[model samples]
Target chain A: MAIINYANKEVQFKIVFYGPALCGKTTNLAYIHSQITETNKGELVSLATAADRTLFFDFLPLNAIVIRNFKTKFQLYTVPGQVIYNATRQLVLRSVDAVVFVADSQWDKMEENIESFRNLDENLARQGLSLDTIPYVIQLNKRDMPNVAPIHYLDFILNDRAVCVPSFEASATTGQGVFDTLNTVSRMLLVKFARDAEAAAYVKSQPTPAASPMDGVAAGLRQPQAAR
Target chain B: MQSTPIVTIAAAEKFLKTLEEFLNHSEAFFALIIDRGGTILSQSGRPPDGTDITILAALAAGSFAATRELATRVGESEFNALYQQGSHFHILMNAVDDDTMLVTIFSTQTTVGLVRFYSARTSEQIAIQMQELRADCVDAPLVFTEADLNTASQIFRDTTDKAV
Candidate 1:
């Protein structure tokens, strides 16, 4: 979660762009980087290794002003594709405030979509979090393909108690529903954050304790010059 | 279910602001909360920046369970605290009332007194927050994903080695 401080107010949230590999996850980000007004997004840092693979991750920061009083900020990220990157994928699912599960929607990719969706559920369980509890969305990418699955079919598969995660169909390559999907997720994020605010307010009036982190944890955050 | 105690935004802000201040003065990484069962509630610090905390929380839970097993072998029910001092810094986890944990990251640059001073205060603050959450937890059942941790230890170890 990226924390933002504005006029003495702060909001911290996380946005995850989850999808099957090469469903234009990176392309969606590239488009956002090029189109957004500078004040919105942060530096798109991609930590790649010698072979040019996403060794660590890529980060995109964006802000929203929905409530008249509170300002919200989101840290958007894409888990490295490829099944072998499972460890990295697990790590990216932490403290996610909201999720956009982008699906590869060409007709032949049905199995991949289902697998990716299942993988998302699996990872959430590891963190003791579930789609049923957290706010999430579904995005159908590569929608322009000739053999893309019907929207109804894809929707039926994803529907659940946490069912029917809000979804959008877009050709991320052509900059279709990308922004609209983002906007939908961002709005949902604000709604959830507001709930937290309400809970926080109620807790404070009672002189209650807060869940705290270990000492030296935050204070000791450094870039670590290559981990000597 | 009724909620735990409430954790107001004002309270969290004050606590986090203090936390940010502490982070500004120190160079620690990876401090988070662990349950009696080792589930993580929240985390602060810089190490898991790119990595996901949800995943780390589960791993920490696993590590905590491992710690309990190790403690039991020595005739103890649980391990109150655990620390691993790498070449450059410290990874510390302190047990609080069996129901919660206070994990911290430290460096030799700061004196032990400073670490103690901050932790004692922060622990109380976190304890308060936990109580609030407990009062109103919406207790949702979660399914664990075995595949995510499927990396044969060597693969994970290799990645850390490569990163370091």
Candidate 2:
């Protein structure tokens, strides 16, 4: 869920980039941080081990594209993708509004991709959410590699959901398909948010039905009657 | 799904005032109230030049979450506060509620004892305000039309069209 602060006229969304080890989740963020205008971005913060593997997560804050007089800010995060870091991954998923699943495209990494995807599902389930309920996009990354699997195979394995989500083929190192993945996910999130808000507003606008005598009697029976 | 939290202007003003008072009492260089998810809700006092408050809030929340996990591994439910001592600057983060935290950054000018004392008091006050804010929060619907969505999409495309 987004945090909307009327005081600052700011609406913020948390987007997490999740994938298996060395799948270029941080590479995607680093490229975005370098390309975006300085005024529109904050410092790129990475908590990594001495060997440069992500120890905790990578965070980047971006302010872009105001809508309806409110500045839209995005707090982008990338979780440590190693299997042992599942705990940290779950923590990073907290309060995330959208996700970009960076799937490694190399044929040899298919099993790790599947495992990470299942881990993502389990973590989201712990928060009472699922891919069907949340807006997410799949990025078939490392497409520039020679041993990459075909797009159709990756889609059949990962995007075989109730509804096929937008997936992009990318080489994050070269910035290919990075922005496309981000832009598509962001647009989907905004549209879904708008639709949900509209539905909630409609429900709120409906008049409540008056309780009949039997309903009142049942309510009275459920709770002790107040003294007259 | 948990309801999205909204901080109204009045509520923000109240929180800022509380944070300002905490800064004054503790003589901290900076103070902030960040949600557990790492979004900064309110802040007070001036940060050093070249400091990015947004990153500060995000890192603080991350540090706090990691510490809480450590606490759980040690058989404790959670740690109430975290203190980091640097040679020049120090930070004290206190849990305001399950969903929010109070972070104070100070220098050698103030003692840790004083900052901790004031942070505890301020956390209670902010927690009360948070309770009230949550109770009064109405799911303010975003009245976005299809045109609005199209305009937003166009803006994003324009911004990213030429990658620097």
Candidate 3:
């Protein structure tokens, strides 16, 4: 969920990088953390195992842009891509506003990529969302490697959505196409947030109907009276 | 299905004041009200040198989530609070509501019992205000023009170009 704080003059969005294990999900984050100015980026926190595989998640917060007099901040996160960490991944996706589906470009990893994509869809479905509902972009990672799948073939399998969202070809370790992917997803998230805010304003401007008995009950139910 | 929560100027001021009062009473060096998603909503008191409050908020939220999971695994629905005692500093995190938590950093000088007592009261006050804020939240709508979005995109491009 995007938190727009008029008081603080700040708008915050959560963007998650998701893909299969060893698909350079952590590499994308590490490269960005290294490139971004220190003042604009926070410490990159990763909870991983002894082998450095992501056990929980990796987090990086960036505050670099201002839109409409509001300081725009993006909290970038990557879920543990291993199959056994589905629970941790779901926890990290709790309130994500956008996603970057980093697909491994090697031909042999196609099945893993497909399974991860389906997993993403299933997790979002559990939250009452879908790829169509949330703004997401695709990244064909490790393009610099040999024996990579053809770009057209990758698109045929993954980008065959109702609307083909933006996709980039990149080598995360060397920092190729990293910012392009980040910038595009960030822009899409900003635009969607703006449109949603406008729609909310439109609804709020409508006339309010007379309050009924059910209205009070509904309001009561909405209150978070419990301590926890 | 809930709309995105907005912290208006009035609400923010009230929250800061509440936090400051809690700090004064509890003698904690820092107090932060962070959302469940780990975004710092309102914070008060001076942090210790070399303390990254942003990262601290994120880690606190993560730790709290992990604790909740542990609670569930142990047959409890949830744990309302988490306390960590360090050599010189003690941190106490209490649940304010479903969407936010209260975190305080205190020295060994202050008793944990006092911190807990004040935290419960402060959290209750914050919970009421948060409930009221959610019930009737009205702030200026965030309307972005085409020029604004273009400017934002250009900023990103410029930053990326410079970094590269």
Candidate 4:
């Protein structure tokens, strides 16, 4: 959901980071929060267990871009990736504008990656949304690990979706490729807004069709249906 | 939730003003209206700088969400109100609508009974207006041109910094 606050001249969007357990979803957000200046970011909040595992979600609010005299803000969130946290993940995914699928690139984690990807699609569908149409990117994370799989194979498996979205090789722990992933997704969301605005303009310019006698009867029928 | 519940600046400010009046009568420290996603829509009677209102809003929303689950597991529909007692101050939260929450903070000067009684009345009054505001929210279309995109891209230019 994008918030257009006319009073404050601010536009806000929600972007969620999702993936399998221990895929560095939280690390990506921590890196971004640390890199940005205090004036450009908000306090990063994490609800986790004693072992530092995410219990529900992590949130970091970033405000930097200015569009059309309005402050463009992005509320970044990371869902709990553990398998048992599926219900919590579904709750966070609601009203999302975009998603960043952070995949663990180690050879041993491929199965977990694939299962999480499928779960993303299923959860999205339950909300009447489709991952195929939503603006998203793939972050192949943990590339610094020795057991990591090759980028080509990772892409062949995860990135081979209907649209073949952008993919980045990232070491989230070291902050490699984190900003790149954020920048691209934010740009995509802005572009999407532009396209939607254009479509709205085109619709407004179109002439209304002439109404026939049946139009009144049809409207009368709708009144009773609406009252019921 | 296909259409975003647009909280216009005008609507939010009006809401805050109303809540502020209630805070005065109830001798409350502050009041905050938050969206379901944990964004602070409006706030009244500011707390000290040491209190991060943004973080407070997020945590309050999270707590309310977890409580909602607990209510359902106990074979209840949902718990519309929550109260937490601190050392010197007490907090009360209520649902203004399905997508919004109202939180009031007060010290020992006020009683929980008074806050709870007045909060329910205020929530009902605010919920009626919120329904009307949400109806007009989606109608305000965002009209962006090429210039907006160019400016947006150039403004966030520091995203490439590799600092961790």
Ranking by DockQ: 2, 4, 3, 1
Q: What is the per-residue lDDT of model 2 for residues B71-129, given as tens digits with 9 covering 90 to 100?
A: 99999988999999999899999999888999998999999999999999999999899
Comparing to the true complex, what docking class would candidate 2 get? Answer: medium
Write model 1 residue lDDT over A22-56, tens digit each, in one string: 67677777666666667665667565577656644
lDDT for model 4, please: 0.83
Distance (Å) between predicted and true CA of B56, model 3?
0.9
Regions of model 2 farther than 4 Å from truth: A218-228, B1-4, B139-147, B153-164
Judge the docking of candidate 4 as incorrect, acceptable, medium or high.
acceptable
Worst 10 residues of 4 chain B by lDDT: B155-164
**How close to the true structure is residue B54 of candidate 4, measured as C-alpha lDDT?**
69
Q: What DockQ do you compute for every candidate structure?
A: 0.02, 0.52, 0.40, 0.47
**Native contacts recovered by model 1:** 0.00
Stretches of model 1 off by over 4 angstroms after superposition: A1-7, A49-53, A160-162, A195-228, B1-164
- Show where candidate 3 strays beyond 4 Å: A208-228, B1-4, B153-164
Residue lDDT tens for model 3, A1-228: 888777889888899999999999999999888888778888999988999999988999998687767898999999999998887787788778999999999999999999999999999887777899799999999999999999999999999988999999999988888888998898888888887777878888898987798988899899988886
Candidate 2: chain B TM-score equals: 0.89
> 2 or 3, which is superior by lDDT?
2
Model 3 residue A212 lDDT? 93
Chain B TM-score of all predictions, in order?
0.57, 0.89, 0.89, 0.87
